[model samples]
Target: MLDQKFATLPKLILQIVQMLQNQSPSDSLNEIIRLVARKFVGLGVLEVADELEIQEAILRLEKEIIDLEATINSASDIKLAYAHNSKLEASGKIVFTGQGAYMCQVSAGGDVLAEKKDSIFRGGRLIVTGNAVLNELGSPMATPTMVEFVFGRRILVNRVYPGVSFRVGRQLFKVQEGLQDVRVAVDEQGILRVDYLYKEHLQ
Candidate 1:
């Protein structure tokens, strides 16, 4: 029954071919010829639609790959550093409290030596140095063992004293002394900076 329905396809194609030979080149004629060719080759319109969808999907995948590569390259260009055998020293005014606690903020002064990006400095130690005074009223003993330097929420140095250096990571420092008012001030334009001197490993 289906064969009988399509038995006139050949006759129909012949009519279209004859019509095209007599007609001038036009969009409608071209469309009719394309449809007839597809039908004769047993290629349905649904198959052509599926092929177009597949091509579009491939294009989208290629675009996504390009975007991903760009993101990875951007991430690689970002600068990051870890604590190594480096020393950060700073001198600033220390505000001493009556309870023997001291607070100070030291700016990097744009001369932050640790800002240098060297491959050898990765995963190295970090030592911090600065002027510290022990409050004699708080500890009753002027010893390095009575002083403590707190970095942010962590205890950086439990035992320290004036002119003694300690190790610290990337964090702010708050000194705890006996009851001494140790003040180190800088010029109005001068920034209380930390000088980071890398270890000899980088040499």
Candidate 2:
């Protein structure tokens, strides 16, 4: 069980800080440790008197977060720019208006906009705080693109192709087929589920 949790620790760390900007990196790291403890307990790993093993495990997780700190800190709390058009990689409140298909891997501190009608995110994601306006998300195949919004709990799409999924607060929604001018949200309940969103999801 300890090994299982250790193996999943890296993935958990990635999700914890993915697009989660505007906060101090140190604070985020601290939060990661706390979350790790809770995850262990939830996963049926009881509290052990062998605190050394846990400390070592947490130290390893800290190094993982440190490596990710550059990418996390690259984004600003406010609107930021995309580094390259080819990769379509950007973060921090971006407005992208492009054409054709591309691996649009975006991370934002707040909102994101895919302005043009031809802007397509073939196999990527739009992770943000509030809303994200996109022309297209996901491919006709594969695992589909992901749109994760927590604050506004809304995602507007001009043309949402098949194979798209969303993670709004603690709730999860997926688009198996296509749709046009779509608006996805978790309703009013998203804000009230503070336990799952903050404590559980963050856990």
TM-score of 1: 0.20
- Put down candidate 2 lDDT per residue, 1-203, tens digits, no spaces: 55654676667566556634554456646765675666465653566446566666567676756666665567554332332334334445667655534555666666777666777666666677756777766655644777777755567766666567778656666665556667776656554221111111111
**Model 2 clashes, total count:** 0
- What are the clashing pairs of model 1? 83-124, 84-124, 84-125, 85-124, 85-125, 86-125, 135-178, 135-179
TM-scores for all candidates: the values are: 0.20, 0.48
lDDT of candidates 1 onward, in order: 0.31, 0.60
Off by over 4 Å in 2: 1-91, 191-203
Q: Following a full C-alpha superposition, what root-mean-square deviation does model 2 have from the true structure? A: 17.2
Locate the minimum summed-lDDT window of 10 residues in model 1. Answer: 116-125
Tens digits of per-residue lDDT for model 1, 42-66:
6453454444443443344344335
Give the Å error, residue 24, model 1: 57
